[model samples]
Target: MKKASLYGTGALLFLALTGCAQQSKSDAAAQLNDQSVMALNWFQQSGEYQALTYQAFTTATYAFDKAQSLTGKPKAVIVDLDETMIDNSAYSAWQVKANKPFEDKSWSRWTHAEQANAVPGAVSFAQYVDSHGGIMFYVSNRDQKDYAATLANLQRLGFPNVNAKTLRLSTTTSNKQARFDAIKNEGYNVVLYVGDNLNDFGAATYHKSNAERRNFVNSNHSLFGTQFIVLPNPLYGDWESGLAPGYNKLTPEQKLKVRADALKAWDGK
Candidate 1:
């Protein structure tokens, strides 16, 4: 290998002559921020996101109409927190700004602060549920350690039923079937289930591979706009988590490679 002389001119010439590929590759890599960051920002900033939520709430109101006709023992609306109820995109944007993958510590810090604003139309929907005899249940996977803060956030945002009976947090598992089943056992027929992730619906959607998740959602064709309302959350969800359910076990670069491999590309010549 040839060596450059120990001078600024020689260093400049060496970089210009032999380092084009290395510099370009690194520059490209360094600029590789997560697309979700932009998606989240867009979701928050764009009128289209407002339109999407308006449509979701429209469907939700229609579902409520059906619920009103049911002569069931009790009825409830099950909703997830985070993106479904609270706009935590700022936290997502924070991670993006720092150019880092998600860190639990920072996420905890954000939750502890309990400053997440309510997602658009969420408060109104919850109020509709409360005003019209529908019990509101928030079944979230937010850590139990953050329970009080989470409750505070919910109360701050004026979400109904921030009490013990309605606020369910994950103490052991992220799979919400048991908790949901408990709701059924308690005799509350879930009229509407809402979340950004399909997993918020039940075990059928939980822990499935990315393809499996899509297939499951497709299989339940009519349920989405009727009994299930989904808020848009491009920041993170089963789309990324379903790809490698054991993602925490992998190294950072390995995780990046897995995401890369998961892409479906057109191989046009």
Candidate 2:
């Protein structure tokens, strides 16, 4: 009888320890999601965010016009789709509400819903480009499986030239340099590259750490608003993952620690 009772207690203790570990994981995930609340609030609610997008697009228009045209090639502008041309903050907000991490299935469902709204000034800028002898290429890292839905969403938002010819989705790699080269090789004079992430510009910063990204930006500071246009995207991007090596592979608890450690807090006087 004593042996049986001890076995029961051992089993209970094992279950209890397992429950505690699961609870700790759950709390860490929750904390990580909660950290995004302020970023989402600013992105979805602030006029400042809208203003920055408009400014980016407005500058892009000037750059597109100022670019000297080649004798035989058509002018082209390469722009990222998500967060640069269309706003996907609703899907991000849903993650916060559902206490879930970003999953491909959920993102695919959101894309299929065709509920993405256009970023401020994006539609107008695209229309301007289409009308002013410039072709707009929607180059995004979005999976090709979401192609039809993404095309439909862009069309519904009244973005011009969103057909299969102009909309290119990711197939294998997200580096985007090959795609950019393809456009150039097709005899189009690609002029401007626009996006919220540094990687969107080209493969120079692809998978690089934050220090390298910052160096690239600093090295090409003259290209801003001319050769490269950037929109504001604080909610999420490669910048978040650039916080640490193998950041994406880290658990939620480890991620939180990395973020906290990255802060440059001043010592109390």
Candidate 3:
């Protein structure tokens, strides 16, 4: 690379990191409050968020209506945490601008008890599900260590009927099918499932490859606006699978090579 070009890239990188640091400082000062409601507002302001919100709402509403029509068994909705219920966009945005990989320690420090907030209409929809004899089961991959804090955050945000037991954390099982099956065995008919990731609704091993994942999504397109509700999460999820799933197995240099390979594979055809 030319000296001038390298200097420019370095300068831009510095500026980006500085901007993220400033945002983090502000977040720290604010005591990591819930911003999901505000994020929803921002989503509404964006053409993309607007369309996604509409699709998600339609799916939830349809599920609710179907639940109301059911006679004997009760209806339930399996919801994911993170981007589905809580808005961690700020964390993601910070990571992108800073050009840093996601660090759990840093992320945990940032998303203290006050950081989690409800997505737009999340609280309202959850409450509705509760009121209409629908059980809202939060099936999240978040570690069990964050359980109490997660519950506290959800409760603080007016997310109704959220209990510690209802949360199936990462401690439960590698496959979410176990969780869903547990729910089914408990007598609640799961009519709707919501998440920002594919594995949230389906089996965990569905997205090992890009082709298999796309096929899964297409095959289940019938559920797109019905039982399967997927919220938009561009910052991560299966998209990051291209970079390789397990980073611990690889050295830093190996990780970089895998990332380079992923980029190459993406651009190849």
Candidate 4:
């Protein structure tokens, strides 16, 4: 009877420990979600964010007009869709409100809802490019499954040239070099690239560490406003994943620890 009593107590202890661990993980995930609240507020409510986006698009227009056109190849401008051309912060805000992690299913549903707002000045820039002897290619890493809904959303927002030929979605790889190459191979004189992520410019910064990403930016400092336009996206990005070597695969508690350790805190004098 003592042995059985001891066994029951051990089982109960094991379950109790397991429950604590699960709760700790849940808390960590909640904390991570909470951390995004400030970023979302800035993105959604700040005039600075709108001003920066307008600045990017305005620079992009100038760059497109200044780019020398070839004899045969028509001028083309490559732009990323999400966060660059359209705003999806509502979905991100939903994630925070619901205390949910980003998942493909929820993202797909959001895309299908066709509620994304156009980034400030994005529509005007796109129309300018489309009308002024340039092809605007909407190259994005959004999955192919969301293509139809994405097309509809862009169309609803009055984004020009969003048809099947111009809008390209991810087929196999998220690395967009192949799609970029295909557009070039099709005889378009690619003039400028625009995006929120460095990887949107090319494969150079794809999956790279933050150090490498910064180095690439430093190396190509002159191209910022002219050849590569950038939009602000502090909500979530590969930069978060770049905090640690397998960050995406880490458990919630581990990810929280990684984020904490990555901070460069000052020592009290």
RMSD vs true structure, all candidates: 5.1, 0.9, 9.5, 0.9
Which 10 consecutive positions of candidate 3 have the poorest summed lDDT? Answer: 28-37
Candidate 1 global TM-score: 0.84
Model 2, span 46-163: residue lDDT tens: 9999999999999999999999999899999999999999999999999999999999999999999999999999999999999999999999999989999999999999999889
> What's the lDDT for all of these models?
0.82, 0.96, 0.72, 0.94
Model 4 Cα shift for residue 93 (angstroms): 0.9
182 in model 1: Cα distance from truth in Å? 0.7
Candidate 1 regions off by >4 Å?
Answer: 1-33, 68-72
**Candidate 3 lDDT by residue in tens digits, 1-269:** 69999999999999999999887655542332232335434553577774675568666877677754456777888999888888876675565455545678767755664586577767778888889788889988877777778888888988888896687887646568888888889888788888888888878445466667777778777877688888887556665564476744554455545655655445456
Ranking by TM-score: 2, 4, 1, 3
| Residue 232 shift from truth in candidate 3, angstroms | 0.4
**Best-fitting candidate, measured by lDDT?**
2
Give the lowest summed-lDDT range of ten residues in model 2. Answer: 160-169
User: Ranking by lDDT, best first?
Assistant: 2, 4, 1, 3
Task: Name the runs in model 3 displaced over 4 angstroms.
Answer: 1-47, 67-71, 96-99, 172-174, 204-207, 243-269
Please write out the lDDT profile of model 1 over residues 112-202, one tens digit for every residue: 9988998889899898889888889999999888899999999999998779999999978999989999998988778889989888888
Question: Please, what is the TM-score per model?
Answer: 0.84, 0.98, 0.72, 0.98
